[model samples]
Target: MPSCQPLNRMKKVLTAQAEAEKIRRIGEAEAGSIEAIGKAEAEKMRLKAEAYQHYGEAAKTALVLEALPKIAGKVAAPLAQTSEIVILSRDGSRVTGEVNRLLAELPVSVNALTGVDLMKIPFLQKMTNPQA
Candidate 1:
């Protein structure tokens, strides 16, 4: 009866220890999840702030410039699949003209995407600053 009493106490102690460890691990997991959520929220706010900072025609132009490569790639993608390209005009004017025609749509595309026209964006005056 004395040995049984000691064994019961030991079993109770081990169970309590296991419960404590389980609670500690749960707390750590919750803390990590909270921290991760906070970081994501902060990143979202930072991006919104950055966007606010760039709210102008110049910024719009810069954005258009950045997207130009992607736009060009998309516009020219069909040509990529062509096994061979044949030039009908010996002077290559046909190809150049076609490219120019494609590029002419860029301003309209930019306006559609950004709600602003790139061509209408005022350029900085150098030689003719009337204030100067």
Candidate 2:
């Protein structure tokens, strides 16, 4: 009976050791699963950030495209309304003299004026005359 008691005690100790080992393995597996979940969440966040950046850029480009025509019209509106005056001259020398005189009398810079302004000059009648 004494020998049987030691054998039974040894069996109980071995059982406890086996149970502890199982519990430790279960804990390790749970930790590994948590780590994997964290990595997946981080990847998802990174992808979301990238998508938002691309969307912002596309929106900005769309806004510029929509506004370009309006911007161009505003820039050209001042030049479109100007009218040309024509002066008829028989001689080339007389035309040149009148043009020089008109240029000297103008308030604004000639170089800054558009081709629309050049067509408006009265002394330079050839520019405005469609028949010539």
Give the best candidate by lDDT: 1
| C-alpha lDDT of residue 95 in model 1 | 87
Question: Candidate 2 residues 1-132, lDDT tens each?
Answer: 257888899999999999999999999999999999999999999998887577754464455445646866897799688786576778889988987887654423432432123334444446446565
State the C-alpha lDDT per candidate.
Answer: 0.79, 0.67
What lDDT tens digits, residue by residue, belong to model 1 across residues 17-124?
999999999999999999999999999999988996768767767777788789879988999989997667777888898998876776778778777666664452
Model 1: clashing residue pairs?
Answer: none
Per-prediction backbone clash count: 0, 2
Which has the greatest TM-score? 1
TM-score, per-candidate, Cα-based: 0.46, 0.41
- Residue 84 lDDT (model 1): 94
